[model samples]
Target: MTSVGTQEKTRPCPRCGAGIGGDERFTVWCAACDWNVDPEGPRKEPRRLDRTRRALARRHGEKLHAGIVSGEDLRARRDASALLALVIALAVHGVTAAVAALGIWCLVHGWGGWPMLPGLFLLLLAWVLRPRPASLPDHVPVLHRAAAPTLFALVDEVAEVAGTRGVDAIVIDGAVNASVQAYGMRGRRMLVLGMPYWEILTPQQRVALLGHELGHYGNGDVRHHTVLGSAYASLITWWYCFAPEDDPAATALELISNLLLLVPYWLVTGVLLLLDRLTLRASQRAEYLADRTSAHVGSTEAAVGLTDRMLVTDSVEAVLAREANRAALAGPSGYRAAGDRADELWERLTSHMASIPEAEYERQRRVGALRGHSVDATHPPTHLRRAGLIAGERMPAAVVVEGDRADRIAAELAGARRLVGRRIILDGPSFGG
Candidate 1:
């Protein structure tokens, strides 16, 4: 493969007659006109349910974006839909309580012979299906304020600007993404920073990322609330527990078990679908609100830059994968240890990102508009987000990370950067594209 800076062959794009440069062995396109930019058409979603959900999300996202463009308020409001979602969530929990009560009744009243066996089984099932509170994963590395004072101080400042509490912990991981999740029974917040994503962002864009994530805490998104979140989790578990096996039943007893579970399984599936539908608009709205908060805190330009960066995250993953593959193919003799390559890894990433043409970003935006491409099923289309930021009121950054402080934050992250860089060299990014 050819690196960006090297002299390579060039040809005019057939569609726009603009010069395209690259190694002949590799694909090249006119960045000026986006010719052949999305050579592969939109990916086929094989699952009928997934396709349906995507369609719904796209439709609702368009509506929400339209609303924003029309100068509708972005503040969270508990309208009928939100209230209904809460009611349904409570009803789901009620069902769980009923199951638990039944198990307790069985244990107390049916403590004899075969009845005792079924009673224990019911109790066990209830325990397994219980609503789970948020908790932090034990394995990932965590950063605290005392250890990374400069970075945490920046985060605290961003949190203050967003009108939310600062995170309880900061988790650094290798994925090409960032998120804020509520954990523990008390709902302490954790900000998960994906170093791959972080390394590519500009300083202001980094602040915007923080503003957007922290904004979730104040957004009142039903999907993130404990009652709804835990209930959704419980319903998922219930669905899996009762779902029929892929293989045909092996015996008469197995067949009976499947038959007995089919109705409840479908019931759980229906509830899951209903809950998702009910919360869909609210979740998307919350995301938009967060984006607005990002803009308010880091300035609209920075937030828009962050969104544009998101549009090309696929390229980021591809480049990282290539680096990892190169390392693997070279073996120990061909290259230094992964730790030694850390600085080089980031430098290459920064260069690659900087080398991307503005036309290429525009191409991505166009492709996103065509495909309704979003960060996931959860987020609005990236193009729409960029447009929304452009349309909304613009403001100067509420919190700025000046050059000296930016350097200090980078210095603090140096150790973490090395660890993540080594991991990526060994196993590639954990985002799985």
Candidate 2:
């Protein structure tokens, strides 16, 4: 059998017609494509070291990253914390139940009666029925190895601004974005980039995006989200206990429980969902902080503004545009390529949007207006995000100027600065001023 160690290779600069002479000419710059692929694997991996040495070298790295988790890997910590909250509440419910039982015993004896016993039961029952955690995986991803240095550079800026350790892993996926995810107890962390990110964003924008993710990680954010999620969950208990069961705690308890059933659970659920969304405002606030950090590191306004651009996201609109409508130029897979024409497609889809039903379309328009407020959503609109910079609200991220990357970086900074509608000189000394 032939071994992969010996192979021939030739490739071009994916963006332009220039021939990349060898593996050394490229870096993992594109968060979108993961990394440049060669027909030959050497072509990529063998240049650094042999397979055995590479495997052995990662042992120390694995140890260093032992506690970090990110992205979907967050399920474990979320579930564990949720379970803990439930246990505490259940313990309290037990106490509440016992007190109610004592009241019932008194009422049965023809003594003055207590009425809250049934409400306690309702609270317990709600706790038992809250949604269970969804299953998650235990695998660590193999991100584009070439992108590590650039990702590290961004991580270093975050560390400087945030006063903490740098990122642990640089994961590449297909999401059109970059996110920071931490796992384990001691912040085993990752800088996860989606493949779509490169196709859709410029380098400065990518840097800004990384800064946003870093903001979430450095601010002790995961724990905050967990606590907030649990609090929102506790609302179920609140609604349940608003009135007890209808069986009869004297006659008044029965009447109240029946009346309580009329209490709008729908309204209660909406209120709980709203509270959860507001709690996530903390995460949103963290984004602004991270952007500030990125600007401090010398990321151009353009780079940071890239995130601002994406903030205008409307998934519902994007989906509708991609329907069987004639303007649907491509499907999801086509959009994954390095140069998929997303803007063209979005424009095409919107152009034909006049044909859809009015009532249904109106609802979507309302959704577009409320895009940022949904409980499970993240990332804000590009224009709204851009407005911050124009308003002089964010600092430019420190950008890397090397080789061909230099010219593009400068242009990106200028582009982002314009989008922000304002500019500030970003020097190394002043961090938070």
Candidate 3:
């Protein structure tokens, strides 16, 4: 589902490429023109079970946090959590096997340690292979050789100023936008800034953007989203794999439990989607935290100043100009927007959307289909994102919008339903926590 009310980690506009922050969903418009923000949802309800069934929807990971995750503690926690999960998984497996063997084998014949042997090894392996916190490596790469130690050193430098640990990595994606893909137990798996994003903003503004992404990663927001999302995805796969094999007349109890395994992410996405404020909301909050981090690491003026400079559009335009370079490579009609087939597909999709109830879930599904994920994936449309920055531009309060701030952060988000390029929905809450 697309995000309506939710906040996103503020990135430069995917369309206009503006680097602004605020939460004004409906006010935002498509990057293509002055289209209204597409409302992305009528949230989807989880697939239902009989009245006798009992299962609560899974938690939508949307709670906002203040400040940031402390570096030392984060590292400790990552190691501990990974260790814990490994131990639990192995212990569960071992005890099951050992008890089964100890009972069944002894009853059937004499005692045997053969089966228990593997269990012992598993337990040992679990302890031995528990997750370890990854340290920033001392060596620098050729691409970063110019900066050398300074490259990663800068990460820590920024973090030190922010009162956090250094970031995970400094990726260089060809895209103009940047993202933080936190991994391990606690340490972040940052996509960091690409050269495009870097070139546009002044040094201070760049730091502000970095601080924002860091806020999300440090708060365990990234971990919560990814882990829960992975779990939910696993459940969906379980559902798809078993759907055909399960009895059509399955009992309600079985059905509910089975449904629990399959429907949580979509369901969670649906509810958060309907609420719609999580992305922009969470994102807004995260941006505020980053701002604080930047201010703490450096100065508040720099943080705010950085935000302003980052908003300048010329750089994003330059990055997108590269797309034109591939015009020759683009086939006749150069993509699917113009053809009769594309038109027919669009009509069919809109027709299908029209049939659904006016709710956040439905809107999100429609948006997801267009975005090319699942028919109900939990993401907002790209076009809507372009509009949000512009929406802030329109709001007088937007100029001094405060996020992660103790101050008012401009506008509160519009009611959760967001719209864009024929898709209106919310970005779903992070799947798991």
TM-scores of the candidates are: 0.88, 0.41, 0.36
Best lDDT among the predictions, by candidate number: 1
Where model 1 places Cα greater than 4 Å from the true spot, the runs are: 1-35, 242-262, 330-336
Predicted candidate 1 versus true structure: per-residue lDDT over 107-189, tens digit per residue: 78876755667777777877886777766656556888888999999999999888878988898888899988788878888
lDDT of 3 by residue, 195-299 (tens): 334444444455555655555556444223543334333333423433422678888887776776556445534433322222333333434344445554434
Model 1: lowest-lDDT 10 consecutive positions: 22-31
Ranking by lDDT: 1, 2, 3
Deviation in angstroms for 35 in model 3? 12
TM-score of 2: 0.41
Per-residue lDDT of model 2, residues 7-49, tens digit only: 3245655766444332221222222232333222221233211
Model 1 scores a TM of: 0.88
Candidate 2's C-alpha lDDT?
Answer: 0.41
Candidate 2's C-alpha runs over 4 A off are 1-150, 185-187, 219-226, 229-274, 277-284, 298-300, 311-382, 393-396, 404-433
Backbone clash pairs for candidate 1 read: none
